[model samples]
Target: MPASPHPDPFTGWLRDHAAPLTHLDPEAPLDDLEPLRDLIGDARVVAIGEHSHFIDEFIRLRRRLLRFLVERCGLTVLAFEYGFSEGFPLDAWAQGQGTDDDLEGHLGETVPVGVDDPLRWIRRHNAAATRPVRFAGIDIPAAGGSLLPALTPVADYLRDIDPETLPAIEQAMRIAASFAGTSAASAAPAWARLPAADQDALTAALTRLLIRFRAVEPLYVSRGDRRDYDLALRRLEGACQADYGFRAMAGLFAGNGLTADTSARDVYMAESVLWHLERSGPGSRIVLAAHNAHIQKAPIRPARTQVPGPDRIRLQSTFLHTPGLDAFDGILHTPAATVARDLEEGKTP
Candidate 1:
C-alpha cells in the first residue's frame, strides 16, 4: 500500500510539545513565555543558544527569552561567552555608569563584539531595578585576541597587593607579547612559531603568579578588598587558561593536533559560570547566552588531531566543535535566518 502522507510519531510529538513563540520583542509582556516555566522548574541556569551568531532574528529572540527568564523566572545574571577577566568594566557599564559609546568601546576591548543591544536592554531594565540583572563574561580574555586582557588586570592587582611579585607577571606579559594575536586562530599559529622554551616559560610564569596569589591570600585580602582580591585571582586563573589554550591549539601546527583533551575556553567558561553563581549567593538563577555548541552535554571529538594524539578524542563539546543544542531548561529556536552571513558555508568567524 502507498504510504500515508502523515509525518512519523517523532515529528508529531515534537510539534505537539513545542511552545509557539508569539513575539521577538524583548519588551513584550511575559505571558506568552509562561510555557517555559514548567521546563525550567528549579533549574539554576537557563542557557539560550542560537543556531548562528549576530543574526538579527536570533539576537531579538535571545533578548526576548532573556527578558522572560529575568522577569518570570527571576534569573538575575547574564553569563555570556565573553572573557571572564574582562567582565568587570562591561558590568559597570551595564549598571549605567558609561555612555553608550563607552559601553560599546568597553565591549570591544574585552572581546570581539558584534552587537551592544543585549547590554543596552539590561541597562534599561537596571535603571529601576532593586536586584538588577548583572552581566558576566565566562570565556577567555579578548576571545584569545590577546593575552593582555587577562594579564594586565593581574599585573595591576599584584602591583597593589604585592609589588615584589611584579616580575613574574611581567615575564609572562613579555612572552605573550611575542605570540598573542588578534584572535585564537591567529594566536595559535603565532604561538607555534615560538620556541618551546617560550611556550613553557609562559605557563611557568602563570603558575608562579597563581602560587603567589594563593600563598599570600590573607595578606592580599587585607591589602585590598576581599572581593577585589578574589577578582584579581580569578583574572590570574584566566591567564593560566589562556596560555594553556594557546599552546594546546599550537599543537595542531606541530603535527600534534590540539593537545588539550578538551576546549580550554569551554572548560574555563563552565567554571566561570559556577564561580559567579556561587558568589551571587543562593537562590540566584542565571541566564546564560552563547552559541548552541557551547552549551551541549554531548562530548565533542577533537578535529584533525596530528602526531601524538588520538584519532578520535572524546571530550565535551565547545565553541570549537559542531553546533549543538543548549536548551536544557528552555530553548528559543528562531526560524531559519533569511539573511546570509559571511561566516556561513564553513567560513570561520
Candidate 2:
C-alpha cells in the first residue's frame, strides 16, 4: 500500500523481492508459497534464516517453509544448526524410531529452538513414504557444547577398527574432560585455562587420529561399512574443529585478540551440508534451517551487542560463498522483524 514503507533502501529491496508469508500454519494449503517456487529455482539448498532465534513468528515461518520445501520442492533433507554428532538420535526420531517423549528429551537438550516441530513432522511424513525424509545437523556437536559428542564417536570407531589408536582418542578425551563435561558453550573458557601442553596434546591426539584414519581407509572400510567409516571420519573432523574454534575463542578471551579465527565452525557446517549433498546424490535438494547470520552472504553488523573478545568477528555463511557453489539460493523472511519492545526503547531486556 505505502511505497517503501521503511526509509531504508534495503527494506524496499526486501519488500520488492520477498513474498509475504500468508499463514504460519504448516498444515495450511501452500498456495500462498507458490511464488517461492520461481524465486528458489533450481537451488540445491534453500536456507531459511532468522535474524534472531526463539522468536515465535520467525520460528513458525520456518516450520511452514520447511513443510512447503519438503512436500512441494522435493527437498528430502532438512539440515539444521544443531549438533552434528548428537543429531543421530534426533535424525532417528525423524525416521519414526522414537516416541514423542524421547524426542522431547533430545530436542530440549540438543537443539536450542525451532527444530522440534520440523523433526516431528518429518517423523509423521516418513511414516508411510518409501524414500522417507531426512535430517542433518551441520553444527559442531551440541551446538558448541562439547567435543565429546564427536570425539567419543571417533573413539568408538577407533576402538572397533583400530584399537591401537584408542590411546590418542582417550588422551584427547582426557583433556576435553576439563571443560567438555557437558554440552555447553561454557567450555571455551575452561579449555583456555588448560595447560598449553595439554592443549597442544589434544591437537596432537586428534592429528594422529586423522592420519590413522586416512592411512587405512580401505582396511577400516573392510572392517566396517564404508558409510560408517566416512561418517566417523567426518565426525572426528567435527571434534577437531570444535577444538580449533574453542581454542581460538579461548585465546581471544585469554589474550584479548581482535579477530575471530578461520571461522572453523562455519566451514565445517558448509562441508557438512556438502556431505549431505553427496550422500543424497546429484540433483537432490536440501533445506537448511539456520540463523540469518549463518545463511546470509552479506555480513551482519554487530549492533549494540555486548559480545566480548573482538571489535569484529569473522562472519558465518561466507564459507558457503564458494565460487560456483551456491549454498542457499533462496531466503524467505516473515513479517515480524523487531526484537523486543524494550530493545526498540533502547533498554536491555
Candidate 3:
C-alpha cells in the first residue's frame, strides 16, 4: 500500500525537520541537546509543555531536558503550574531548608504528586548543587477548593504590619470560608448560593484590601523586610484573582463568559513567573512546566455559536509574546492512529 502515500504533505515536512530523539538514553546526560542553545539563546523564560500529565515517557523526557537546562544552560528556577501559595513550601524544601518528608507531604496536595520521579530528581539536584535551583508554583492556590489558603500569608503579614487592614482581609477570608469543600464541584454550589449583595461586598472588601496593601507598601517594607512584603502582596493578589475566577465559575450557567476567567488565570500565572524572574535578577533562566494549552503561543478562539456569544468576550494568547520569554511545545508526537482517526472525523488531533 506504500503507506497510503504518506497521508499528507505535512508528514514529509515534519520528517524533514524532526530529529529522532528516541535514540537518546533517558538516564544519560543531555549533551545532544546542546544544539538547543542556539535556538534558545539568552531567553530568560523557556516554557516546556506536556500534552498530558502522569505519562512516564513524557515525565522522563521533561526531566532530561530540565536537567540539561539546569546543568548546562544555567537555569535557576523550575516553575510548575501548581499554585504559588502551595509552592512555597516545596521551594523551601528544594532549597534544602526542609526534609524530604516535608516536601513529599506538600507535593501530595498537588497534581504533580502522581508523577514522583521527576520531582524527586529535582529535589536531589537542588540539594546537591552549590547554588540551589528554586521551585515555583505559578497558579492560584485553589486546587483544594476555596481561595482562603492564598489569603493566610497576606492576612498574617497584615496583622504584623497594618492591623487596621485585618478587617477587610478577615471579611475576604470569611467569604472564602463559606465555600469550603474538597473540590470545585462541591464548593461551587456554596458560592452560587451566596446573595449577590454578599458577593459584591466580598469583592469590594478584597479590592479594598489590595488597595490598602499597595498604599501601605513603603511602611510595611520599612517595618518588616521588602521580600516578606512582596511575598505577602503576591499571595493577596493570588487570592483576589482566585476569588474572581470562582465567581466567574459560579456564573457559568448564567451565560457569564468563562474565557475572561481563563485568560485572567493565565495572566496571573505569567505574572507570577515574571515575579520570580525579577527576584532572581538578570541572566536567570527558568524552566516553566505547564500543560501545552496554557503555555502555547497561540490565541484562544471561542466557537462562533458558543454560549454567551464570542463578541461579548475577549480572548488572548497565553505566553507567546512575553518579553525575553520563549515558549516551546514539548509534545513530541501524537500516535499515528490517533491522528488518522482525528483526520477521518474532521477533528483536530
Candidate 2 TM-score over all chains jointly:
0.81
Query: What lDDT tens digits, residue by residue, belong to model 1 across residues 1-349?
Result: 8877974654565576677877777777878888888888878987876655656677777778888888778899998878888787889999989687787567553323333677888898999998988899888876776788888978887887889988888998998898776577677788777898988888898998888789988988899898999888888888888877776666655677654533777888889999999998768899888776568655554433221211221132323442122223334566665432424533343
In angstroms, the error of model 2 at 30 is: 1.8
lDDT of 3: 0.69
Model 2 lDDT-worst window of ten: 317-326
* Collision count for each candidate, in order: 2, 1, 0
Q: Clashes in model 3: which pairs?
A: none
Error of 2 at 283 (Å): 4.1
Residue by residue across 17-98, what tens digits does model 3's lDDT show?
5555543345795766776777667778888775554445556677777888888888888888777887787777776776
Per-residue lDDT of model 2, residues 1-349, tens digit only: 7766547654455567656666877688988989888977888888887656656677777888888887888888989988777778788888878676788787654434567778888888899876788898888876666788888878888888999888888989988877773443467767777888999999999888888888889999999999999999999988888888876787575676546473778889989999888997666888998765566664434333222211222222232222111223455545465343433444321
Query: Model 3 TM-score?
Result: 0.80
**Predictions ranked by TM-score, top down?**
1, 2, 3
Candidate 1 regions off by >4 Å?
1-7, 109-115, 253-255, 258-260, 301-331, 338-349
